[model samples]
Structures are given as structure tokens and as C-alpha cells.
Target: MAMIKTYRRDDDGVLHYREAWSEKSGVRTHMGAVGTKGRTRFHSTRSRTWPDKPTATEFLDNFTEESAADGYFPVPDDDHGWLVLQCWTFTADLSHPDDQRLFEHGQDALDEHLGWRGVGHYDGNDLGGKPPAGYDLDGTVMNLFCKVVDTGLGVKVVRSFARAFHLTPYHVIATREPGDDNDYVLAWSPRKRDKDFDLFRL
Candidate 1:
């Protein structure tokens, strides 16, 4: 696998990311917001930008340096964990049995819901079409796009789940998969789903 370099920046609460890597004959980059698939471009080794560098790796390293100087800091290599789209209910305090039971009930409800699973797709190749403002496409990250097989059942389940938890209806959370540092909410729906979720909303 080619070595990939990732970087992130925060602009007035919005998080954006960019990725660069070397290919056999070129260098590629993707830049956009944290969740959505962003735009991608390839710079062929035969281009003028490549003649000075001995290899694609060298060219990419030089490009990364320029990006860093422009305020994009490298994201830790271990940060490439999967993000999951699921239902979330509040648990005031896990140590309290009442909170535990409420949380368990929500979990059970989510697991028992029918037609809950959907076909998840990720960007494996550069795709065309304008992504909404502030979005990027990178093959290295776990950015998921879902299509529910049964939309009728899916919407009903979502509504029920929200009501059961006494949360504002018609919302869902895209959070870090079970055990990755913390249960960071990457994004949320029926609100500002296109933007990264606020990390300090505790």
C-alpha cells in the first residue's frame, strides 16, 4: 500500500481534512470537510512538477511540507479508525443504574429494530460530481455513505427510536465505532449533517 499523509484544520468550529499519497506514476490529493467524500486530483509523474523529484514519494513529501507550512497539521496515523452511523440516546451517568437501564434499553431497541442495516459504500476511486460546499473524497478514511434497502421501515424505526428516547425526532448520529479513543460524534442528521459534529457538545 502507498504511504498516505493526512492533515486536518479547524476553521471557526468546522473541521476539514486533506490527504496526499504517492502512486506508481503520479501523486494524488483529496481535500474537503471531515465527513463527506471530497474532490481528488492526480499529478502525473511526467508533468513538469515531477521532473525535479526522483520519485513520486519525493514529490509528495515536498507537497506535504508546503501544506504544513500553510497551517494543515498532520493527523496521527492511528486516527484512521472507522466511523459508524447509529442511534444515540443520552445516559446522564453510566454509574447510575437508572441511567444504565435507560441506555441499555435504547441499545436493545436499536439492535432489535428491523431492516436496520444498510449497504455502506466508501470512496474507492476518484468520483466526479460536485460535492456540497466543504466536502472531500479520500480513499484512506472510513467515510461512509449509506443506502437503506427498506426506506419505509428505516424511517419509521428512526422516528420510533427518537421518540422512545425522548429526543428531538428524526435525528441520527454518526459516531466513532465502539472503541476508538472516545465516542466522538462525527456528524448528525436532521440538523447540520453535512458538517462535522461539535466535539465539545457534552
Candidate 2:
């Protein structure tokens, strides 16, 4: 079972908890801060001495709930998956007058302008290579793929991209991966399929 263990710092008597769990690779632990005498909430990772053990435990419960709501889970012991910081899925309407530039200029123009590489639909070619037939940017609905900066900057990046391209981000989600740091791959597509290389889910 996953648990949060509390500890008091020897130097300052500050209380903190180490949230850890068993994963396929090994145990994964994350630290939480329980502030000093007057501060009851665990705001961020900072040194704080709790008055007693019960206070630390109470804060642990709150931290666990917040972590869960943020889509953080114990690294699975079996399926080798990488954590997804944030994913934004949206379709650009090529018919829109303002968005018609995406269809007129094609993906090559976008790639050159935004420094984005093209990922083929049939084959996993995502290095600015040519996409497979019928997957070009000539369709009425074009998919936009933007590399997420990080969890903290994901939403801002997505929204900025959407505004620049006159598109809308319909879906956004964050995930935790247990496998390699480079395992999470990003790709754009108009049609959704199970075999698509970019379709990763927890």
C-alpha cells in the first residue's frame, strides 16, 4: 500500500512527509512540507516544524488528496508508461476565414514557421519528414501538435499556440509515467485510431 511517512528534521525540528510507493523500477517518493508552528497548510516544499505528530498527519491527508486530484499516481509495477505532463487536443477549422491560412499554406509552412516536425499518420515519422498520403494539411479539419514545455507551463503554451493559429484546445490532461523519461511521444492527427503512435493513455 502507498503511504506518507512523516519525519522531523534534526537540525530545525521542521516536519515533513515522504510520500512513497512501490513501482516496477523501485520505490518512488515525493516530499511534502508541513509548515511551522502557526502555518497549518503545506504550501510548498519548505522547512517547517510541526507542533506535533497529529498536525503533520492531518497535512499529509490534504497533500494526498491534492496530489490525486492533480492526476498523480503511483508508478505502475507492470505497464511501462511515461508520465504525461499535459496533453492538449484540438482541431483547427480550416473553413474559418482566419484559419484558412493553415490549409492554404499546408503543414510545411507551419513547420518552418513554428519549428514543428511532421509526424506521419501511417508510419511513425516525426522528424519533419513527409507524412503518409491523405494525412496532409489540405483537409477542412487540421490537427495541431504543440510540444508541451512542462507541467507548470503546459496550459499557457497550449493556449498561446491555439491563439496564434486561430485554433481551440478542446482537451487537456496531465499524467504520471513510470518508465523512461523520453517515453512520452507527441503527434498530431485528424482521425483517432487505436494503432496511432501518439495515442498514449494511463
Best of the candidates, lDDT: 1
lDDT of 2 by residue, 1-202 (tens): 3354333233564333335443432344445432211212223222245333333334456656766665444323343222221222222333555445444643444333222211111111111222233433332322333332122233333333445555433222232234345444433223454223433321
Taking all chains together, the TM-score of candidate 1 against the true structure is 0.40
Model 2 residue 86 distance off true place after TM-score fit, in angstroms = 13
lDDT of 1 at 108: 50
Error of 2 at 69 (Å): 39
The runs of at least 3 residues in candidate 2 whose Cα sits more than 4 Å from the true structure, single-residue gaps closed, are 1-99, 104-141, 168-202
* TM-score attained by model 2: 0.23
RMSD of each: 17.0, 16.1
Name the runs in model 1 displaced over 4 angstroms: 46-54, 77-82, 85-202
Q: Where does candidate 2 clash, by residue pair?
A: 14-48, 14-49, 82-177, 83-176, 83-177
| Cα error, candidate 1, residue 74 (Å) | 2.5
* Total backbone collisions for each predicted model: 4, 5
